[model samples]
Target: MQSISELLKFLTGTVFAAMPRDMLRELVLPHGHVALLSRRRADMIISRVRMVAGLFAVLTPLWIVIDLLVFSWPVTGLLVAGRLVTTVAFGMLAVSFRKSIRMREAYKALAMMFGIPTLFFIYSHPLLSHFDMAGPAAAIAAGYAFLPFVMIAGLAVFPLTATESAVFAMPVLCAEALVALLQLDMLNWSSHLGAFWLLFLIATVAALAGMSQLSFMMSLVRQATHDGLTGCFSRTSGEELLDIQFHIASRSGAPLSVVFLDIDNFKKVNDTYGHDAGDRVLRTMTEKLRSNLRSGDVLLRWGGEEFVILLPNASGATATSAVTRLRDIGLGTRPDGDPVTASFGIAERIADGVTDWHQLVEIADQRMYEAKMAGKNRLVGCADPIQYEAVVNA
Candidate 1:
């Protein structure tokens, strides 16, 4: 009998282990998990408002029908009040979420504010006698029903620290234990209902876990690919992307162009106004580049006071024209209210077998120096072989 019991335990443990963590998270976490994941707090607010609206849309008619059928005007009134309160809560939460996002506050503030009220409704509603559940069994079931919401809100508000998750798990486990105790007493043990709630809880937990993982992964990817200061692609990642574009253009026999830009007298700006102003200047330049470039073109911070623009499917002439326009636009503005300008060198991969993107960049860079030496705020092109040769000589 001892051996048989041990074997049964082993089998149960194995089955649990085989279940997907994502599935368990979805079962255990709340529906509001989607709201927590929004890139902006406004997005979260909009999502929450939609949820509240949807809930009211369904519950309002149901309450009306029940009131007419049972002739219970009081119950209908309570339902209306609940719906109104929920709507107001939704609106408040939305506003708070927006504020939190803008302020870059601890993410949990919105979650906690939204969650505490929800928990109160779940725990206190039945005790008011307007709702159906009254006994310990009802309390146990209600607690179980509220578990996912609490867990999800916790996830949104709290850092995904292991200690925090363990802390949150304690209350959930306690709720499940209470439900189990009620079932053991044979007082309100509906096996079907218990199984359904358990399944739902498991699913929610699994989903929350999955989303957390995905969010973390996305954050890492963004950090790796983007410049920390300007939010443009880093030089290495940009070059790799340009390489891929070059390969595609070569195969299609289409033109691929590069424009190298260097801020004229950038060091003077840094020396005169301090690094903060220099940073502001870089950010301003980035904004201009992002705004002026075509959707297909990519702008990258190549290095200090330097940027690279990749224009695919653009001829040498077209690339020169674009760079000239960029030079005009960039030089037109003074970020620090001081005189500023940029020199540009434009180049195009005109033939096949030029697989090395670095060579094109080097050619552009050389021409850019030529423009700077000849006169600042000028555009040079690879089409001028003699000029390039002179640039190389210089």
Candidate 2:
């Protein structure tokens, strides 16, 4: 029984080991693990979409010359009309692109980017099929058939999840299939099937490439945003988050809370036990705080022995109650085997009437100083500090 259990364990471990460990949940799901990561990724995707759309806008109208030269009269007119509409749509999308574009808007922009060409392909293929032309005209008309392939291959340019890539590629696939169905009388079933099979292969490869880009993007974001010591967000990323959350709260009329926490006498731990022991205490405290806080709450390492927690949609009273419970439970143990403690300062956007996130952080920092002066290991908020002198004195 023991040998069989061991074999099972080994097999499971081997299977997991072969899988890409760093391919986060975001690689498979359309959404990211954190809102901030999703927002950043959206901004990147929108920028690229805008650039590609702009290129299409410029290059699309120029194709009218080819239509005039290859085909004559009404066919040329119909093709030019379709090209104008597509060019106009691409132009509008490119000009409207902004850094603050949301994920929903990014997805919509990507769809439209692929969508414009698909519509053109559908409109032009039947027109082209009507003409039994030969030589260069035939070759130029054949180029229109490759539009779906080009669009599917374009998916490789952006960092998108497997789900997002599949979703975006679906419309183009349908468009190609629809055009093939319409042209069944002009072309044989075998030729159409072969073309579709090739398109599917290209789409599958493009989706895989997109997923690879997403994986690399995830790695870059994780390294850039998180602190090496505590695995908390760095101060730079924290500032960006504060600005984003604050604006969101202000717009929605929701409360945003900030908690400024500082370890008590942290220098002594480094002075006595060593920097390694101090590192352990920091890691332990981070684990305790993360285990206690809600998943939505963001923890940032502000500086040495200082951390900031952002609680979105949480009021001052809610933050006070939560942190009080945490205090009661205790943070963790120090190098000396004694209880580890911290001073906390809380500030809420609605309660403080702060105009900006900077003001909120400043208020919290000031109250943290008050906590330090009123005796350490206490929480100072909108009202008085939570006194722990009685317990300490005992």
Candidate 3:
């Protein structure tokens, strides 16, 4: 029994070790990075979805002219109805789309953009299939059949995960299979199979294209939002994150805390040891702070030698305790072989009764300044700075 268990464990470990984890992640899962779903990415995808929908709204109805010229009045009328309905749906989607759309909402819009054409194809294909194949009508039938391919190809325009691309293409694929089933008496089995094979190949290619776009977007986001040296969020992106978290906390009536931290005598490090050593100190400090933070907490490089830590759902007391623990652990050694230390100030939303995120930051900044003045390497986390100051002076 022991041997069997050991063998199973070894086989499981070998299988996992041999797997291409990065490739699997790209193909099977959405990015776990918060920046990937940031408001910037949401807006970009929403704008693209609107543009494609608007284009389809105009193009879908215009195709009715060809239907009228090629087919009989009865077939043309049925096709025109489907086209009009599809056009209206796309138009409504394009016009009603808001600029502040979220990620999930963007995904729904993408689905609608693909779905309208797919429904039109399902309705119109059977109408065209009843007639004999040849002439302009044969050409028209071919156009309807290509709708699924066109929709799958459209996936390349959006930044989507491979999983999202595959899921979106499923409806179009099913519609094609359904339409083919309906026309089995007209076209041979071999033709349906061949068409399905082509679609599968096209979907695979489209998924790869979408994943490439996603990768490109992620690279851009990382460059824009992260600090190049310390790997923490940049000051600009950090402010945006603060605003987002503040509003979320306000809406839910949850406590939000901000910790303003400045390295004690950081400027002296640069003046004495040079800027490269200072940069190393910043990176090392960031690493230590990150190691002690919860997964949901955010660390931002506020500026040179200054950092901000956003602690969502944490009270003033909780943040104070956390910062104290970090202070006790220390921030590693400096180039001069002295231990690095920092001044910390914490402010909580409910405790401070601040109406906006800026106020919260200002309070934390003031307290941090007070900590600096009260002799370096201290924390001022009290809600009432006046009382804390009196005690410090006393």
> Which of the predicted structures, 1 or 3, would earn the higher lDDT when compared with the native?
3
Off by over 4 Å in 2: 1-23, 383-385, 389-394
TM-score of each: 0.45, 0.90, 0.88
Candidate 2 backbone collisions, by pair = none
| Model 1, span 2-114: residue lDDT tens | 86557546644443454455433432343322222333333443344444445544543554454345424464466546655655664455444343432124335434443
Candidate 1 lDDT at 115 equals: 52
The per-model lDDT (C-alpha) reads 0.58, 0.84, 0.81
lDDT, residue 262, model 3: 91
TM-score of 3: 0.88
TM-score of 1: 0.45
Top candidate when judged by TM-score against the true structure: 2
True-vs-predicted CA distance for residue 282, candidate 3, Å: 1.0
Off by over 4 Å in 3: 1-28, 35-37, 382-394
What is the lDDT for 206 in model 3?
Answer: 72
Provide the clashing-pair count of each candidate structure: 24, 0, 0
